[model samples]
Target chain A: MVRLSLAMILCLLMVTSGCGKAPSESSSKIKSQDPASVQNKGTIGFSALTLTNPFFKVIADNMQEEAAKHGYELIVLSAERDVKKQADHVDEFLVKGVSAIILNPCDSNGIGPAIKKANDKGVPVFTNDIKYDGDEGKVVCHVATDNYQGGKLAGEAMVKLLGDSGGKVAILHFPQAESCQLRVKGFHEIVNAHNGKTKNAKIEVVATLDGGGVRDEGFKGTKDVIESNPDLAAIFAINDPSALGARAALEAAGKADQVTIIAFDGQQIGKQAILEGKILCDPIQFPDQIGKVTIEQIIKYFNGDDVKTEILIPSKLHYKEDAEKDPLLKG
Target chain B: MIFMLLLLVILFSVLTVKQQHPTGANAGDQVGKTILAQYGKGARVLVVTRDTEEDRGFAQAAIDRLKAAGADVLGQVNGSAIDARKTIESILAEGQTIDAIAANDVTAKWTVYDRFPSVGSAKCVTPKPYMWPNFLKLSNLMSVANQTAIYAIIAIGMTMVIITAGIDLSVGSLVALASVSSAIFIRDYCGGTEASVTMVVLGAFVGIGICAAAGAFNGLMVTAFQIPPFIVTLGMMMMASGLSFRLAEGRSIPELPSAFFWLGRGQTFGLPNPVLLMIVLYLLAHFVMSRMVFGRYIYSIGGNEEAARLSGVPVKRVLLAVYMICGALAGLGGIMLTSQLSAGDPKFGLMYELEVIAAVVVGGTSLMGGQGKIFGTLIGAFIIAVIKNGMNLTDVDPFNQKIVLGAVLTAAVLIDRLKRHA
Candidate 1:
């Protein structure tokens, strides 16, 4: 009975609080700008699934710098590796009436409702780095590096580094992302191709580890591979961070120079390593270009033009010498 | 001794887990970079003893000097010297690398490892401490206190149930369901109008009370039907989870009306309403446990069920009420969570059951039943929250945070066990 009474009181508080006050005529305070009078010149919001990763931070900075040239406000909000929080940020943008949104989804599926809401409200939305797997027609446009092609490049690079006698190669992949899966698939396509081409050095995939898309996991997974197979001739990492982590582990095991390491998404660290000849090769994806193109697509959507739903950005292979000289590959 | 041994085993497992980094220099550098980004660039943080009063301004001045040079600075103090020691030890243990240490008090003890830059050894006379934003500081404190309160309310009921030699795992799920249901009713049905206020309150209570009935169902199954508490609550846990998912309609319901939001989000006399509600619930539970005839019966049943039955105590009815109380408190926690999030995602309370149980067990509540206190669980809950929040502020690796939490949980249980033997 006491519990019931307290529950009743709590309910009463909630009800009274809801009725506490109306929005003080603020709804009428700012009259809606006419569609003809709408001048799109203000802060541009970048909402990421998570800003915890260094890759995302780089993307955000590039976008922020580019947006500054147009006198645009760049509000970067990190979802702290949470899909719900990312969704919340989307809602916040809609309420705040942002000019445009650039999203890096935590999960392709979870952002569906939020993306739909923004589209219905006539807010142009663009996605970069990661593409949604759901109906591609729903989002305005997506700009991302071909993860599958990059993975195949890494695989081909590894096979070449291993020479004619294909030795054991380990694959470290992120389990949740389709992009990561595609990278592994591409790598296998190349590695399997080399199996028929190479005689003595046939690349054998000894083990595959799920790195969970974290550097620490990559390090641990690399160690696990080494421990399980001491003669791992090469390692194909899903991304640059994981490749670096794997290299760190290999260095610890005193086999850094012996095993050729290859990574995707040629991030700064990966580029630096490539310049220093630490990695065999890393595929360079212009994240900044992806960001810029995403905004351009959003703008096109806002202009009432039928925008192409898909935008695939090709990746270039970054060897030690190429990354050393190319300033674009530096970051 | 056994409890200590178990704690030692857990600690050893965590510490000896094959470290991937050989030199650990690179990992340490990465961790430092992460810390710098999280806190800010070139941040000089001072972890001090709680006993040091704010009047000692030298350290504050030193921190200020560092900050003026484009460095971010932060300081932390806990309840006591022992706590300070534990906090530092946990940080070092998790960090696995120390760049520097600065101290004056007992410098002779740990100064040997202070190979990094040492600021000073002289103790300051007056410490002009920094102040946090009123809202943020209050919110942090309230979060800890509110978390404790929720655990306390549930612990009181749990203690009662245990005293009657009973247990309830279904409480966590029931809490989630009740909170979600009440939030929906308030936001959707009531819609924050003056006339709907009474109805909203009634809706919340009715929602929670129905959950209590679910607990009563568990009690009835356990006592009347002669099933064990473990089996009964476990099954109810699944049932409650299914019910919540069905109610949420497979999507998060957000932007709850201000009235519903106020229930959990508002502040009363500078304390979060949830914290206040927890306190009120605690007082009522304390009264029911300490003063009521049913409370006596619960204790009697725990002391010896057969004897209590022979002694004319209504063991079954008391057990029923005890489980009902546990369910009701969980409902309250769920409601607060709903209010805080201003949304119901069916998945909001995932893995919460483990944390709640950890708090209860660490608080001295016996898994075997018939031993614990509401107050103990309250402290345990606060400790967990502090450790988590501190880890976040200190920029501990997410993986290391998990390891540290597991260690602390083990240590708490060990401490509880020692007290029991003593």
Candidate 2:
């Protein structure tokens, strides 16, 4: 147990050190373009949806590192999914006279006045992960993962696993989430297209159950579906937690190998699940890239460059092979 | 409670010491003076400012001072870094060399000057930033009051309800209901964006009236049916939240007229409208609690309901009024929130009932219902706001902030319990 703990610590240290240099190096490489403006720029304020989520945390960390390289300070605050709190953070940012402001808006529409406030102050507002589509405030740029494409990738992974002889499938869905909806839509498009191409071996979606985008709900939904349909071919979960939950339910029902799972969000746990052969694979989002790109846009905006209104970072499929190479998971 | 509020104010003020950038006319005039000193008469100057009212004031002052002092005003960029970049590009293209760029402090931070080699950032003249605590800034103080006004206003009703030995968990949901109702009233009945001032005011009253009805229902249940206030309010909380979602179709209503924003965002006498409204409501509530017959009856019922009835006090009516007032104020909070955020969301007022109750309790108001002060609740609300703002200014960890807030609430309650025991 002691050895395992030590090994984990070492692995974590390696991962942190490896990641710490990446954003700075890349930012420096970008800074090579404008070597003249290398002195102290100013401060950038970021209010995240919640830092409790490792996704937002990663984004904040990468942004801080990247901003430091370009001689800027990043002040991060967690809004805890409260729009009022996020608005207050924006107000505080304005009060502090920040050079730029970034937000993962708690409410796309409710956050409009706060964005308008920043815009009025001439502080550039950027968003990531959560896009603000309100008509009131102007967002200089938005950087986020392409959830639809990630979903399509998940669907393609489904086909690759069972394209030869497809059977019955179930979907663990969270319809309320816009990103999840896009994922399911992309998955459906790909699966339906695959079915249309081959008549003999068709994948039939027998059950589409609400998993609440959470592990406990996913576990219960999977258990109920397994009881009704014992010959289920596969399950497509909108995210990692639900996928892992489905795997646990399948194992509990003594049908681990009988069913396969394809998930989105290659969170550390999801990768570990793939490495352990509990879940198949995941289409991962690049929160790190989102953070880096957001800072890049802010720098360019300050540098008198016209930035794109929206930037979508592409998601990558992570199989067991990629998980094995991950330093955080290595002994 | 006032001491607590004062202490927090001082603490946050000290912690938030930062460089305060100058804007508006005076700073612009200062920058103009500096430009004149460095570059003598007829020095070509480009006036750069953000397109805000304050920045425009700065630009006006700078342009006036520079032109009056015989310096040539090349042009002005009343917009973004990109706009300033374009203006400078055009200026350079016109074969005109700028002796200086007159801009406000915020405008001076823009790295757009780096793009212009001849007119580097050094050529820009801005008023020097003064060192000051952010907490003490008039703008920050106004914002703190404005944000706290919602909780402070709602706490008045909560304080009265608790004073009468009753609780209202439904105020939070009522806030949402009111927000949704007002937004829908303006959008569907009144002409949304084209809504008149009279119609907008009427829409706000409509929102408050609905919550008042709900509050009246809560009072009826407690007074007539003899149900516990906690149980009744808990049930109402769920029902109102669900009803609001149903009415709103689970989406926020952002179609209200810009004039409607005056209540939440407008200022009077250099103070936020909500803060002014909170001050007025607190004054009225204090009067009712201290000088009025209704206030006396409320105290009697809270102190001893059976004894109050024996003493010819109208217990039921007072109770009903108290609940209704609580609901109405919560509705007002919802309206203020809608105006502040410029949207009426069913998700508005999330956990606000608890927040107001906390303020009431923290302000040294006993939950046992017979002893509390209206002003105490105000101080309590400010205390919470100060802590939150101070924590944000200090860059405290978000998770740790929750722990700190939890500790403060616990400590306040514990102190209350100990004081009661003593």
Q: Candidate 2 — which residues are off by over 4 angstroms?
A: A1-39, A206-210, A220-230, A252-255, B42-44, B69-75, B93-98, B181-210, B224-227, B246-249, B257-260, B268-270
The CAPRI quality class of candidate 1 comes to incorrect
Write candidate 1's Cα lDDT for B12-50 as tens digits.
Answer: 233222211111223223333433444455655543422
For A171-268, candidate 2 gives per-residue lDDT tens digits of 99997667888888999999999999998889889999989888999999999999999999899999889998899899999999999999889888
- Candidate 1 regions off by >4 Å? A1-43, A68-72, A135-137, A326-331, B1-422
Per-residue CA lDDT of candidate 1, range A1-331, in tens?
3234323433432333223212211221222242211122444567775566667777787777766554354667776655544655665555444666778875565466567656654456788877765442266577888888887777768867876666888888886577888889988998888788767778899988977656788899999889989988888888877888898899999999878888888777778888877788887788777767766665444333456778877788889778768776544
Global lDDT of each candidate: 0.61, 0.87
**What shift in Å separates residue B130 of candidate 1 from its native position after superposition?**
42
Query: TM-scores for chain B, in order?
Result: 0.64, 0.92
- For model 2 chain B, the run of ten residues with the poorest summed lDDT: B10-19
